[model samples]
Target chain A: MRLVTTNLTFAEVQPKLREVVDTLFKTVPAGVGSKGFLKISVPQFKQVMEEGVKWAVDNGYGWEDDLKNTEGYGKIEWADASKVSDKAITRGINQLGTLGSGNHYLEVQVAHAANIFDEKYAKACGITTPEQVVIMVHCGSRGFGHQVGTDYLKIFEDAMRRYGISVPDRELSCAPFSSREGQDYYKAMACAANMAFTNRQVIMHRIREAFSKVFQRSAEELEMNLVYDVAHNIAKVEKYKIDGSWKEVVVHRKGSTRAFGPGNHELSSRYQEIGQPVIIGGSMETGSYLLVGTKKAEEETFGSTAHGSGRTMSRAQAKREVRGEQLQKAMESKGIYVKAVSMPGLAEEAGLAYKDIDEVIDTLDRAGISKKVVALKPVGNVKG
Target chain B: MKQKYKFFDDIATADAAFEAYGKDLPELFTNAALATFSVMADLKKVAPKAKKKIVLKNPKAEGLLFDFIQELIYLKDAEYMLFSKFTVKVADGKLTATAFGEHINPEKHQLLTDVKAMTLHMYSVQQTKSGWKAFIILDT
Candidate 1:
């Protein structure tokens, strides 16, 4: 997930919400078979796999500061393009600068003054004024990641038989982290991670262009600074104090994300005083939250927190309960303007399908995993 | 009577799940392709404007099914194509097929979710009383 704060307020963008959404929907391709604007060759795409957002910035896709705001500077240093398969490269080469379908979205939100929980953290993170307009993008490495996973899962399943390892479920296939197969998968997965960062960075560039076109101002003049970008369901090596000694282990956070607290050396200089920003995206109808990591999380939860409001209902059930067109009309009546490519797709993501986000965040907060900084209510959305 | 395919409501919550049925191996493979593509687009709206051929060999019928669906998804992502109609033949562990569809046009096709990959969770191919049945869970 990634968030960007603009100088414009919600009141300023509300009247032009439809136009803004339309502009974004046109600029950012969504839904099945959505292709990107940039067309790079397979070799050039390999450079992207290794270099991540650096390649984007160097190629004029984004600004230098975008690197700073991104997690791991928007690139995984250990990523190896050679470890990535030809099929994975083929799947990802054309998918940059696009928003994919199914629960992925780009939303325009407002940070109401009453919703601001900690003014100090909010101000530090560029939420200085009431009704501050922000953009949140929820997507990931696209088909490239999926292919990498498919390739490795097959390899690991085969490796398990050779290594005399057994699991009850085939989906839980694994190879020891120290094994060659495991290391190859790790490096290949890093390449996919880089691909995702570059993907979002390229999309961010498109978003900046869209906002500039709609508002009639340069992105810099609009102060479209990216607050932060983070990933979920990723595993990385971290040092944790276990028993009497500090041990380095590969922490696989499925359906969770890193919530490193303040003063942690892992944090970039910009976020050293404050903790890592944890973006918790809720359903499009309900609001989302901006929270900072806590020291307690590092001690108790392996520096991790929840990824999002867990789904309470399945997609088919949601579609059975809600009609997309009716849901759209209802949201418009409730002041949330939305543009969707497919109605059935829209119904599948109805807010009723998700759990109460406030309750989820409250649980995290009470446990000191993260602290609330700001609450953002949706005003406009481009649903994928 | 055997239906071509049907989507399941509770099998996989976050992704898509479906079951495809056929009287034999070839029909089963063809119906599986149909079921997989149906998740990404409306078959009726996707005109068969072009054709492509596929030939794959896997010792296991289940592996062949997985590869067949994976190939379709790969084409969707790599070539920007969606196939609504398929003609498949599976013989002696070798599978060959032809798929027909057009390049996806946002204006022409009622495109839905992109089926990213096939998953191993609850994925199976079995023979029932009347026909061959296969269960698939696609990661969207």
Candidate 2:
């Protein structure tokens, strides 16, 4: 997930909601089999797997400061392009800068002054003004990441047999971390991770350009700064005090985010005092939250917190309960304009389909895992 | 009652789960392909403007079913095509399929979820007293 705050406010953007969303929808491809504007080849895409957002910045798609605000500087050092499969490359090569479907989206939100829970942290993260309009995007490595997982699941299933391992379920198929297959999977996963970082960076570039066009101001003049970029599902090797001694272990964060507290060396210097930023994306109809990591989280939960206000209803049930047209009309009545590729897809992402965002954020804040900084309510969205 | 497939309401929360039925392997494979693509596009509206031949082999019937559906997904991403019609033949551990579809034009097709990968979670292919059945959970 990523959030980019701008100098513009809700009042300034309210009238141009449809035009802004349409411009964004056109700039960034969404929906099934969405292809990007970049026409790079397999070999060029290999460089993307290795370099991450650095490739985007070097290719004139992003600002240099974006590197410092992004997790891992937008690249995974262990990424090895050779470890990635040809099929994975083929799927991901044409998928850069896409928002993708099934709950993934790019929303224009307003950070209400009253919603600021921690004024210090909110200001520190570049969210200062009342009703500040910001862009929040929820996406990931796309098909490339899925294909890597799929390839390894098949490989690990066979490797488990060779290793004489038994698991309760097929999804638990595994190989020792030191094994060749495990190392291969990790390297391949890193490649996908890098590609994902680049994917968001490319999308960010298009977002800046679109805002510039719609608002008739340069992205820099508009102060369209990326607040932070984080990965929801990723595994990283980190050091922790285990049994009184610091040890390095692989921490897998599935459906979770890394909430590294203040003073952690991993965080960028700009956030050294505040802590790592955490973006919890709720359903499009509701809103999302900006948070800062807590020391308690680092000590108790391995610096981890919930990724989002998870679904309360399944897609099939959501579609049955709500009509897409009705939901769209209802949202418009409430001042949230939305553009979707498919109606049924829109119905599946109804706000009622998800748990309450306030309750979820309150739970996290009360647990001392992450401190709420600001609450951003959506004004417009481009759904994939 | 006879049906090609039915989506489950509770099996998978973040993904789509379904069961495809057929009287035999060929029909089962074809129905599975249709079920998979239906998650991506409105099959009735996706015109068959192009065609592709797929050949795959796996010793396990379950693995064969996995590969067959996976191939269609592969094409969806690699070729930007959505297949609505399919024909399949399985013999001597080899499966051959002919799929028909067209380039994804948003104006013509109502594109839905982007089915990324097929998961082995609750995945099964079996022969029943009445027909062949397979349960699949697709990652979106």
- Which candidate has the highest lDDT of all? 2
Model 1 C-alpha lDDT per residue in residues A300-352, reported as the tens digit of each score? 88999998997889888998999999999999999999999988899999999
Expressed as tens digits, the lDDT of each residue in A227-296 for candidate 2 is 9999999988888888898988889998999999999998889999999999999999999999999899
True-vs-predicted CA distance for residue A193, candidate 1, Å: 0.6
Docking level for model 2: high
lDDT values, one for every candidate: 0.90, 0.92
Compute each candidate's TM-score over C-alphas.
Answer: 0.98, 0.99
- Please give the TM-score that candidate 2 achieves against the real structure: 0.99
Q: Which segments of model 1 are wrong by more than 4 Å?
A: none
| CAPRI quality band, candidate 1 | medium
Q: Candidate 2: lDDT of A43?
A: 79
What fraction of native interface contacts does model 1 preserve? 0.78
RMSD of each: 1.2, 1.0
Could you give me the TM-score of model 1 versus the true structure?
0.98
Error of 2 at A250 (Å): 1.4
